[model samples]
Target chain A: MGDALLEVKDLVVEFKTRRGALRAVDGVSFALKPGEVLGLVGESGAGKSLTGAAVIGLLEPPGHIAAGSVTLGGERIDTLPREAMRKVRGKRIGMVFQDPLTSLNPLYTVGEQLTETIRTHLPVNQAEARQRAIDLLNDVGIPAASRRLDSYPHEFSGGMRQRVVIALALAAEPEVVIADEPTTALDVSVQAQIISVLKNLCTEKGTAVILVTHDMGVIAETADRVAVMYAGRIVEIGPVRDVIKQPVHPYTMGLMGSIPDPQGGAERLVQIPGAMPRLNAIPVGCAFNPRCQMAIDRCRVERPTMRRIGATDVACHVAGPAETTP
Target chain B: MLAFLIRRVFQAVIVMLTVAFISFSLFRFVGDPISTMVGQDATIADRQAMARELGLDQPFIVQFWRFIAKAVQGEFGISYRVGRPVMDLIQERLPATLELAFCAAIFALVFGIFFGVYTALRRDSWLTKVVMTVSLIGVSLPTFLIGIGLIYLFSVELKWLPSFGRGETVKIGGWTTGFLTESGLKSLILPTITLGLFQMTLIMRLVRSEMLEVLRTDYIKFARARGLSDRAVHFGHALKNTLIPVITIMGIKLGALVAFAIITETVFQWPGVGFLFISSVQSVDVPMMASYLLLVALFFVIVNLTVDLAYFAVDPRLRISAVATRG
Candidate 1:
């Protein structure tokens, strides 16, 4: 509401598959405020990762932004050319990807890689860059950063390498950081440590973060707000505690119930029936109609618009707070 | 690292001994050298005396061992064709062949890698297509044909270079200044071009394919995502990653350059090891042939060893894996 750092509206991405034009991200919208963390949660093929990629202008070939407005720091980015977009990608918005082992160059030493990134966007000399690289490595909890800087990527364990990747992302000191499945490749213990580091660093620097992940536990731990995506559209969005305690959308409720609690006795995990529809074969009315337990005849005949539900927004036909129900 | 060197040297010695044994046995297969050198018109007594004098009447195994013993002492007897020490003949011609092969390799490697990288960076462009087409033509054509065609263009039509011979020499205190002199370099031009062009085409294609594969890696993507310029991403990151295959091909190509030098020397009549080898074979000069084979084999082994060492310098991962294996 108050000068969001990033505002994405009516974003739609499509791929030209052999069957048809498959809409991967259909009319997805979200915003990130300064110093805020927004969690985007969905299963594989839910288009959550695609939405993140579109914001960073890193969508692979055959998939492209069809209709959208991505405004970063009040500047329209979706319309910018490639060369200009490249400048904004690393200089203004940093990115961390999945699979740290493959993300880092194996031929270069860790220090060389970090220094290269520092020197790329900053006006710094070699010695300054090297020192900054060591400092960043130390800041990320890598022991003896000075001595370990000379080690190559292959020398580090998987968790340590992910830490290095995070260090690289933070080197540019961008206004926003987009992390896509950042901890999916790490162990549970390492995941907690990485999440803490990311949250603390972003809060310290006042950088907005768009954390794309499937693990709801990560959202519970870090995100200020949660956006639930299904079949390429965000179906539910609200404050993290509100969304977790009382999800209005049946799909969101089903997801929250699926996570097994350590305190709970032996109870059957609630699972939403039916698979996500294929992109080229989406249903006519609501995309989630087949899986919705409270779906009425209107839900099967017409798609629902996003309506307000007690300081929350949800795209559902039959369920919402009374004030905004239509 | 020192231990690796010592092991390589020991292996090289074994390889040399094997080559010497095989060459000695193979040379004998062409029939008795003395009988071949001396005509059938010679009298029976003359033949007997000649066989005894040349030690041909001894057992084959004893003669082979004797040959080896003399070879070890650097006494590769006298060449029947040149009537000089086989070592002396080889030493005289070795420089010319080495010079030609060295120049060709340098020319091929520098230009091949450059063109390969350029084409890969500009993939699907007109320049890349033209370069690839030209390289295909160069690779398909035989070196001899290319040599002949170049001589025709440069020596006959253009009159820019001499057709044959080492040309005039200028000696300065036992060192030759004429190697880089105009006339000397002119004589070398055609053969160097012939050898370089063929290998360059091969190496360029190899480098291009390797570069394309390296560019597709996630590390290269990370480099691009780090805001690296295209030059840094292509040359610094992608090219370095592709060098292992390039270095391996370069080593094998260098060894092949020496082999190609033999044929090139024959075609150009530039007085190199290939010319000496051909005449030695024609006159059945066993010691000279044996010496040449051993030297060439030794050169191949050394080139491969140097390449193996270079791999460690280029990629630290190789060094780490090597050390881990040793431990």
Candidate 2:
């Protein structure tokens, strides 16, 4: 953790809704080490994507970082000026999105997009940037990289376009990539290929990755460590294998149970009994107390912060280590 | 592209024919052309002689047939009021109309797109609010009123520019144009602003809205994330996407400019086809009116076709699928 390539500490992202200030990401904290892959697992509205957006300084307005810090290579970045943050973006961090089509501008040739990005962050002229773009296309597994350079994003197939997006993200050779649901919009058959492409490239380049997704299978395959977020906070964090085999938080347990195992046969997949609380309607104490099956009277009035429980960190009165203060 | 062009050209022919017939028939409702042909003191014999000369003595159907024949032969009949061929009159004034339209287009497109991007980028600013309000007024106010207001401000009160005419021209090669001459260029400013104000508002709002939409697209975010400067993101990425539709709209708007120029020319008394058109309308010069309508309609068709073709160059999806899909 001391040498984390990217560090997110107590990050809180808020949205100014018509009703009032709505806290979407409340005191979430995690760090990604050099060359490490951290999978952020959560249900919809879990603030996982918002965390990624905040780190990249694209927390769409009306939404903003209300508090906390994002440090890249030990330099605090969450509060950097717009101009400064823009420099940090492609030069230090790359971002891949949920949809491939949305991630690549349709009007530009893929080569133009890639070269512009390269020339922006790197000290490369046009010819050299183009060469790097071609190299990146080849690295991301696009066939005939040189020929693919002139293609508009739409000219490529869905999987191929996703590869192009990945190429664009990697154009500047940043230290970390925040891939928010990169595989979610791709077909299942192509998802594996994209995931492998992402994994191999990150591995080869020694780049850290923050992969935000709800797909447990993707986490199981690509993540070195996993963080489970629920209602705007990380409910648990540990090695992916440990979290999958023996989840410490009750919400994490429910999520793990919902991932159907083929060997489990014809049994109905287990689903958590209630929905995640709406922001305005979140409980006074523990946000999850209403939905937690093991919630106690104490749990209804007292929120549980992340606490060490065996090998994992868990935020639950019943499951986490004894409350040190109260 | 070949197929698309062929289909569009074929469709254009149908539209021109329909417009030609409608223009020819609409003249009947205005009553008579003779009142415009002769002086008040002229005799019945002089009027009859004029009618015979124009083939007005023939049956309505036969007169229409002769008109059609002359039109097919590319011989627009002599204007009853001016005693000159309608085509000749149009050709003489064509350059002035083209100049007015070209200047207006440049003014509208350049300013509209610039302000649109600026307002979109500064969405929450009070300046943007003021701009939007002014644009609304711009769109609502009639062109003649804008022309009058501009004339009063620049020509009457300020005495900064000429009020009623296109300025001096120097011979450029074999032809002459007011565009290059200093005073002539000054004369264009008021009229261009008046003629282009509505289109400016229209294109400005379109560019702003389109930029706003394109700015929110995932690719724009991706572009910004790539660390491109704010300028690069807006102009390089977002503006290009915004333009595809804007260009299409501009084509239709170019036609509007020509039609709207009629009112603008009348108010400014600028010597353009629109001025000729108004005089022809007043005199009920059927030959001139018919040719003008046809010419305007033809201009719209050709400009729109060019715009449609331009989409292929800007957007590969259209270019590729143009061939993939059947005509």
Candidate 3:
């Protein structure tokens, strides 16, 4: 019970489809303490990105939070009005998107874009904002900060643009940062650089971060704690090392085994077979039962509740006591 | 950038030459201007002498060369019907046509973009629906019908404005203030509105669509995510992206404006190049027709060139590529 910077309890998000109302994120609960990084790992359509969007109050139309309580820095933000939520969005909870190239405007110079954010959140004049923009560019590792400030987003490389995006998120010195697959668009070599920059900056500022990524390697390298989601529900939550080295939930184990290790010799990587069910046609029982290798008879008739097993939390009837790490 | 400009200038010259040659050939196809102007009842000797005097009997290539040479030297010859210098006739009427087109274009750009942005921002709202419906009608209705409709409403019904003609003369230096005043503007109002209404609708639709598309870009969403205000996202980010296509259409529309002006001027009996052009065409005045056609063609080329250059200013990517090519 360290002081939680953000706490999402019993969060449920639903979308009204042509068929009927479909729950995308159901009763998901998570908390982030100051200076903590919570990696939300899930397959596509697992509602990880939707969760991030809900946290920031940007869940687009048709998909909305049906039931939830989101407390940020001691304030209940879930029920806050639109104007109030907007004030908290960039000033308190910043967001970095998946595609860095499309996440920056082509018309504006990078400096102009950055300065606009600073000016909006801060009580600063144009000259001060401009100076802050130059400082941010320098902080983000862009060369010739002053000169590059005038350069457009297209002028920068993919990784550099991601850095600029991070710079924008950190411009107002927000309390939390939600980076949704920030490195997914960059090359593998550049991913590490961006992750390191983000980690170092968050650490220095004691800002909580919610990193939504599907890459397990990114989670192991950057996250303090990880939440593995399957079909829009968190199947497992624990310390990064514990979850990766010894996963409790069957789905988590399948995810960990799916990754091919470069150091290890040729081994058939275990993959969770079958596609995720569409949002409109979810199974009646546990969402992962169809894909779970160790699913029992009860797993097909009832959804599992998240129960504590030693140091980890798992939502599976078959999840017994935690196994000792090898 | 300089290379682009040079290439554009060369293209413009080719366009002008094509216009000159086509209009010249087309006017001749209708028959010799001298014979047509003099009438069919004239004696064969009189017609032959008239043809020879006017250089109409020369070889087609030689006639084209002579026409081009005279045109370049500002000697457009005399109007066969008016019996006055074609240049003098055009000079007198050119200002009025240019002024009408300029004013209409300005009105269209200002109101069209403003309405477009407003509707896009308020998409699916009642205001947007009304604007879109109006735009559809404006685009579908022919310019003549709109002009006639406006004349009937403003002139025949309201009687608040003049129905035809340029109206009473005002002092040259005081023209700006005089023309924009209640009465001065009243005279030009019907034609300007008729021209601007259709163009404004077209421009508005273009801007609205382009802005809507630009607004959906991830960067605009990111801008909102960064806590930038709605104004910043819509105007600063979205609007800037929309302007490129809008400008491109506007350039092409300017050429259309000149062509439309011909019909508008005739309907209103306004003293403009369009009215002069219509009369020249009716009376078989070849030099007047050629000069007017050449000017309109030149207008399109220059406007398009300006638009091409504007692309460099709006997006640095173009400027960079342009520079790269030059280097």
Candidate 4:
């Protein structure tokens, strides 16, 4: 409790579309400790990406943080001016994008991109930066790192390019890294390899990471804790294993049910009715009420905030709170 | 890479040969240079003697063969109006046109890119809108009209410059006195502005569109996210990507510039090759006219070559493999 590396307090993000100002990230709160991997899981349009973007002060215009504060290392970051925020980015918090193919500038060599970022945020001469770049490429498990530095982005394969992107993000050795769908763009086989590489590197450096993805397998494998988001709000937050084993929120339960069970007894996977609502069509009170199997009048009329249960915070009126057993 | 260069050179050679044939056929097909030369006072015997003296008395086939032979040997015969070799006249006037084109291109390129990028960055500003509207006018107005208008304002009304000619000059040591002289330079201002204005607008539009598109690419987002200043992200990362289109447009515009300068030269009455070309056309000077077309074609080929070489130089993607280029 005393040493929170990154803390996001009720972050609200909205977009000024033609229809109206739609809330993308609505009062989302979470904390990340040093060296901790917090997995942000949600269905499509859950605003998982938007929350991550807001924490880094990069919410796309006309999407902006309406009310919230993102604090890293006890300093408020979200309120900083653009230039100050920019410096805070590479120097304090780094980011990885979903698509790697377009991430690296095609004109520059892999080494040049790494070295430029390193030189910008760190006090290093060209030779030292080049050496660091090679070391980073090597650290990312690239073979013949020194030779590969001269190759352009096009010369690298998709998986390898993602690896280079990771290297570039970690160039400054920032306190935290927000990797948004880092593995979604890679092969399933390569996904495990990249995940392992990311985990090992972050763990070794003691750098906190907010791993944003829809893959439960990724959360299960890598995350110490997980936050489940639905309709731009967190529905559940707890230790990964506790929430996965003793699921609290109905939305979280439905999400887990949708994942196929390894034990073959249940022939068909459970399916939640209807789809996640669009920004305009999201129902009042509980955003998931229309699709929930156990929706009540109470669920349809009043929004629920996080209530402490057994080793978890579950947002639901029906479930109430977990009682301690004798 | 060698193969590409060889292929390009071969294509250029074929184009030159084609232009030569087209220019040669213009004299035979048009069939009135001798009539224009003799005028209403000259008799038939005088015309015949003149034809014999000029070797036009030979059979059409013989004359064609001789013309081709002489053209291949870098001769374009003599201009009746100038009473000198067409090649010599072209050589004398070509430098003036080239200097004008080069100066105009430099002005357009520098300012065009500056304004284009400036406006693109602040797209919603009223200044940007005004610049874009004025640039559209630059694109739509005829060069001769612009030339005359500039002359009207700068030369006639203001009495700031000479209205016609390249002005006088004397050779002094290594430097030329007239070309570099104050009055000569003052005479240059209107024509250069007229020649460059349209190109400036064209380049501005191209740079704006390209920069806008490039600014949206993922790499630029990544660059900004990585703590790059706006200047570095805009000019360094995004602008570099815009180069491919800018260079391509510049090459095409340069080729057009050589051809389009004729109207500007006529309006200014400047003693450049374009002005000479117009007078040659009116006087029915076939050799002079033929050489003028050939000269422009040559410049086009040269500009295209420069563009190709520039691509190889500036963009590593177009350069031979990194391994080959490393040396």
Candidate 1 residues B59-79, lDDT tens each?
878877887788878787777
Q: Write the per-residue lDDT of candidate 3 for residues A73-175, one digit (tens) a residue.
A: 7889989988788888789999999999999888888888888889889999999999998888887788899999989888899999999999999999999
Between 1 and 4, whose DockQ is larger?
4
Task: Please give, for residues A89-203, the per-residue lDDT of candidate 1 as tens digits.
Answer: 6778888888898999888999999998898889999999999999989888899999999999999998899889888988988888899999999988899988888888889
Q: Which candidate leads the pack in TM-score?
A: 3
Task: Give me the candidate number with maximum DockQ.
Answer: 3
TM per prediction = 0.91, 0.95, 0.96, 0.94
By DockQ, the better pick of 1 and 3 is 3
- Predicted candidate 4 versus true structure: per-residue lDDT over B205-288, tens digit per residue: 999999999988888888877877788788878888998879988998978887888988888887788999888887778778
Superior candidate under lDDT, 3 versus 4? 3
lDDT of 3: 0.87
Better of 2 and 4 by DockQ: 2
Worst 10 residues of 3 chain B by lDDT: B169-178
Q: How well is each residue in B1-327 modelled by candidate 3, as lDDT tens digits?
A: 666778889888888999999999888876557666787799989988888988888998898899899988989888898999999888777767877888889889999999999998898799889989989999899888988888898889988788888776455642322264566567777888788888899999999999989887898889888888777778888998999989999999977788789889988888888999888878888888999999889888888988888888898788777777788
Clashing pairs in 3: none
Write out the backbone clash pairs for model 1.
none
Report lDDT per candidate.
Answer: 0.86, 0.88, 0.87, 0.86
How does residue A239 of candidate 4 score in lDDT? 95
What ranges in model 3 sit over 4 Å off?
Answer: A324-326, B171-181
Off by over 4 Å in 4: A320-326, B27-31, B57-65, B168-179, B321-327
* Chain A TM-score values, per prediction: 0.97, 0.97, 0.96, 0.96
| B1-327: candidate 2 lDDT, tens digit per residue | 677779999999889878888888898666579867787998999989988988888877787778778887898899887999988888877777889889999999988998999899999999999999999999999888888898888889999999988889766554457888889899889989998989999999999999999998988888888899998998988998999989988899978898888988888888888999889888888888888998899999999998988888888888778768864
